[model samples]
Structure formats: C-alpha cells, structure tokens
Target: MDISMGDEPRRLTSCWLYWIAVPTGDQAGVMATLGLTQPTPVTFAEAETIIDEDGHGEAEGNPDGLSRVYVSPEVDGWTLVIGWWCDPCDGERDDEVLRRVTELSARYGRAQAYYYGAQGDGSAWLIAERGAVLRRYCATGEAEDDLFTLGEPLPLERARRNELGLSSSWGKAVGNDEGGSEWKSAAFHLAPKIAAALGISPLALTAETRVRGTGVLALTPQGAEAEPVT
Candidate 1:
C-alpha cells in the first residue's frame, strides 16, 4: 500500500482523532503532558472556519452543541478532535451523543483514537481512561481522487511543518514508499486484535505500528517485521 519512493519523502492527507474526556484540566496542562510547550486555543471564529471547510460542525452536526470538530496541525501530525465537553448526561442524551460521535468517527474513520480523561484527584490526567500531538503542513504532489474528477489540494494535506509543530517539514511529506503510510489505516488499527488472533506480535500485521500510547511489536503470523493485512 505504500505509494511513494523509498528515499524521497512524500506528503499525504491525514486526519487524526484525539478522544479527550470531559473536564480533564485547562488546555495549558494538557499541552504540557503531550510534550507540546503550549498550544494557542483556536477562537470560535477560527475553529468554525476550519469546520466549515471540512463539513464538520454543521447545523446537522448534533443537538448537544456539546460536540465540536476542528482540524489542528501539530508536531506529531494533522489532527481533528471530534471531542465532547459535557457530562455523559445520564444516558438520556447518550444515544444522540453517540450518533454524533459516529459521524466524526466516520470522518476520521481510520485514525488511532487516543482517549484522555481527567483523574479524580485532579492533578494532571496524563493517563487516559488512560492518557496523550504537529504543524503547518507541506504539500506533496500525490493527491487522492474524490468526487467528479475533483481532487484535494496537496498543500493543506502536506507534511508536519513548523506552523503545525514539527521540527522539520521534509519528512512530513506523504507518498514516500519507505515511510509513506497507507491511507487504509485499519491494518495499523487492527494489529493488536489480529496479533492476538494469530498468536504473534503486532508487527506481523503491519510495519512500525504505533498506536498512540500503545508500544511497538511484531504482529504477522509469519513472524515478519510488521503486520500484513488480512
């Protein structure tokens, strides 16, 4: 599935999800734990612009207003947090919320969901339910085809850049065969389950699989370097 040259880095379009449990702490502390020095919170106006362009947070979004979806560039990568800010609401509103949740889920369907919630004692919730971001993006020539011969602009979907938070933009490009990740992220996602099923390391299912807080491993049934898609 890797599409770019092994030596030259290719840029790609990536959207990620960060599952932040409600009322974790102020944004200041959250950024710190992620190793991000500080993050400038987007204003409602700025946030709206990004959502409007992406078809998220539309009037059709949800009744709660408790959910907000926005794109953010960071050192790690391009991200979108389909996050909730209210209590679970006695399950009375859970279904609607869950449905809304499903919408964002579909938008970034293949991303690794990193769950983060506050600890009861209140002193920085590093571990999510557990615990956990990139930058301005660089544009790679490779763009996916969508809708009536139209294509997504590569610049917006580029590599992690200084504006987004990464130290370098060169490695951020997608399409590089060696480091270019397949758009179908499910293989990386299902690695753990597949490994357990095959009784092998997670790497067997995929290469250099890094699922947020989850550590590294080999998952292929054949004891290969990384996991192979089933």
Candidate 2:
C-alpha cells in the first residue's frame, strides 16, 4: 500500500535510500552508468510498489541488501535512480559512492544524489558536474570524525549557515567545535530541501510531472546478493 502523505505533501523519508538525478531522458544511459544488469520493464506504479516492499523487507525474494533498484524515465527533463547501494552513511564506502556519482556526472554533465534516512537519523547530498563533485555533505549522527563532507557548501547551504550564524566559509565553521555540531544537527534535515533546490526531490514526482517513458527495475552487478548495510 502507498504510504499516506496526510495533509502534507509526500516527502522522501524512511526506508533509507539514495536518489540520483541526472538531466537527461536516456534511461538506458542511466542504467548503464550505474552498471545495472538484468533490465526488466516496469511501470512507475510497479516500481514504487517494489521499492516500498523492499523497504519493508517484504518484497518477494528480497535479498538481505536489496541489490535491486528502480530507475525512472525522464520526468520533467530529469531521470532518477533509486537504490540503497549508494547510501552515504557508511564512512568506509564514502569514496566508492562518490566515485559512482562522479562517474554519472562525468557522463551526464551533471548529477545529484540525495539520501533521507529513517527517523531523521541521517541525511546527505552531493552535486557533481562535468566529472567533479562541487559539493558533498553527510551527517549520519555517528562518530564525529565519521562525518563525511567535501567540497564547498551549496548556495542554499551557505544561506542556512548564515541563518545559523556560521562563518561564511563552511570549512572554517566546520573547523570550530560548536559550529560543526550545530551544522551537523541542522544538516540532518537538509537533504530533501537541497534536493528540491538543486534538481528534483523524490517526493516531488507528481501527476503533473512531465514523464517521457516508463520506469524499470534493474539489478546491481551482484544481482540478488546483499550489499553491506551501514
């Protein structure tokens, strides 16, 4: 069953997953870029159902790590890749995730990844263009040293820093003990908003969204095997 949005609009939350957006309608390119194997055609509705079921560990034959994903067709000039494989909460896998996102941006001119965790425990976002990640931020509410962050903060993040009375330079503020804690706390909820401003928020997909083709379910390289959960 579809999760209820209540009076508020649908927002990407829980079932912790990563969303990758690229400005193109080429679903094949997206699938190939992610190295996804075993293409299986599915409509948007079916894709959503699969994702929901997998999130609940109730999907038929759902693997331990759900090495499967839903790739949406072009919607309003953007294509979205949804999966848990790219989640940024793992400090050990941070470089690997960034490498994948950079590869996508290198091929598509620009790519963005966003993560929203269950119960607001963590959140992250990365924006890359022309083979370079311009900004990356992650706050997993884990060890302080494990807070993976890189590049400069985006404009929206800068504005938020100002609102929080942080220094103009994000690096400098993060260098401060107090500022770092405050920013991390605030960043825990910034993924969804940053995603909306930079490209598309997962929940922003609506009946009004311009859709060019159907979504599809694809397998990761390991097929039904599990990827380590952070």
Write one digit per residue (lDDT tens) for candidate 1, span 31-135: 322222213344323443333332222333332223333223221222323233211121253333333333333333322222112111100001111111111
Q: What's the lDDT for all of these models?
A: 0.25, 0.71
lDDT of 2: 0.71
* Model 2 weakest lDDT span, ten residues long: 1-10
Note the clash tally of each candidate. 44, 0
Candidate 2 is scored at a TM of: 0.83
lDDT of 2 at 191: 84
